[model samples]
Target: MLAERPWTGYGFESFWGTPLLLNQDQPFDRAWDIRTIVHGHNGYLDIAVLMGIPALCVAVYTFLVAPLRDYMRIPLRKENIHLGDFFMMVVLFAALNAFFESFFFHRADPVWLFFVFGMFGLRQVSLRPMAVRGRS
Candidate 1:
């Protein structure tokens, strides 16, 4: 629904309380922009956000970078990679984040969902297929 860079920030407040979305307000900057700020005051949601790190790692292997080729239950076929899948992945990650922020967090966040996802691609080890067990 909303579109903004991960680094620049993407929060509900930034969307509603800033000039970019709301009129008559100055453009947001890293500093002096109250709407872009977030705090971990929420209980379980705060913990859930922290839990995302490991979930994401598994998602990447499941959806994009299945390193253990043989053991991977249903690796996304390389030939089947599609632009839609990319967007879907981002949406899935964002939805997970939004659940925490909107439900238990009791606060909103401008989380960089795609940033860590992208980093997985950038920093991943070789994608060369490997068998977890010997060829019996």
Candidate 2:
């Protein structure tokens, strides 16, 4: 599918709405059907197919890579460690879930919302300096 439109793609809803797949002259003996496919089932691939590879790269970097890097740099305090763990879990959940679901970047998706909230929380936690509890 990407080979057909690597850059511009077939546009949104192409997964099910595209005549490209529906119009295929498949043999009558075919076990499965393309029309049954509603989504790419992989969030990253869906974005790449619907948007483009560049958009997929940007989305992955923005939502997963950068935030994970930032969270890793956070100081290892009791509270900070907990925050990092929470962030890690959220990131992992979203990342792993994307492998089988097309929920990434969906505004109304609860998982996507939680992922965004986790990213925002990580940003706030990474910004504010950890208090120097023992310092004068």
Candidate 3:
């Protein structure tokens, strides 16, 4: 699917044509030029190189920075429940999963979004404090 859209072309010309300009007199043939840049062999290589570096950075941040920040802000030894902390954890995981899917997979699915919402609902239900206090 990603192969279909060249940044220079209008619709389908770049993917399935003679690679010629429809309008030679114009300042530029936008479609042919963009198609050349995006679908050409060297263009693909350039995109791969560009995308790979940032992807690696994000991976490191996810596995390293996130856990470290979580540990520093919240004491692991405490048994008391904090609603905000739980919510943050849920959001972090959901966001990370979404980011991975969008970056690596190149496809969007609603299942991850559903999972995020489900986690939020479950966290809210579980963290609700009991209204009655030791009267029974």
Q: How high is each candidate's TM-score?
A: 0.20, 0.80, 0.27
How many clashes (backbone N, Cα, C below 3 Å) per candidate? Answer: 0, 0, 2
lDDT of 3: 0.41
What TM-score quantifies how close candidate 3 is to the native fold?
A: 0.27
lDDT of 2 at 100: 91
lDDT of 1 by residue, 11-129 (tens): 32233344543444556653565444443444223333433434435544543444234223323444223332454455446545544443322334344435344334322322332
Model 2 TM-score relative to the real fold: 0.80
Worst 10 residues of 1 by lDDT: 1-10
lDDT winner among the candidates?
Answer: 2
Residues 1-136 of candidate 3: C-alpha lDDT, one tens digit per residue: 3333333233322332334433324445454444233333332232333344344456456543554454344433233135435545655565455533332222354644544454444444344542434556
What is the C-alpha local distance difference test score of each model?
0.39, 0.80, 0.41
lDDT ranking of the models = 2, 3, 1
**Regarding lDDT, does 2 or 3 come out ahead?**
2
How many pairs of residues in model 3 come into backbone collision?
2
| CA lDDT, candidate 2, residue 51 | 84
Can you list the residue pairs that collide in candidate 3? 8-34, 9-31
- Position 67, candidate 1: lDDT: 26
Candidate 2: stretches off by over 4 Å: 24-33, 129-136
Off by over 4 Å in 1: 1-81, 103-136
Residue 23 CA error for candidate 3 (Å)?
A: 21
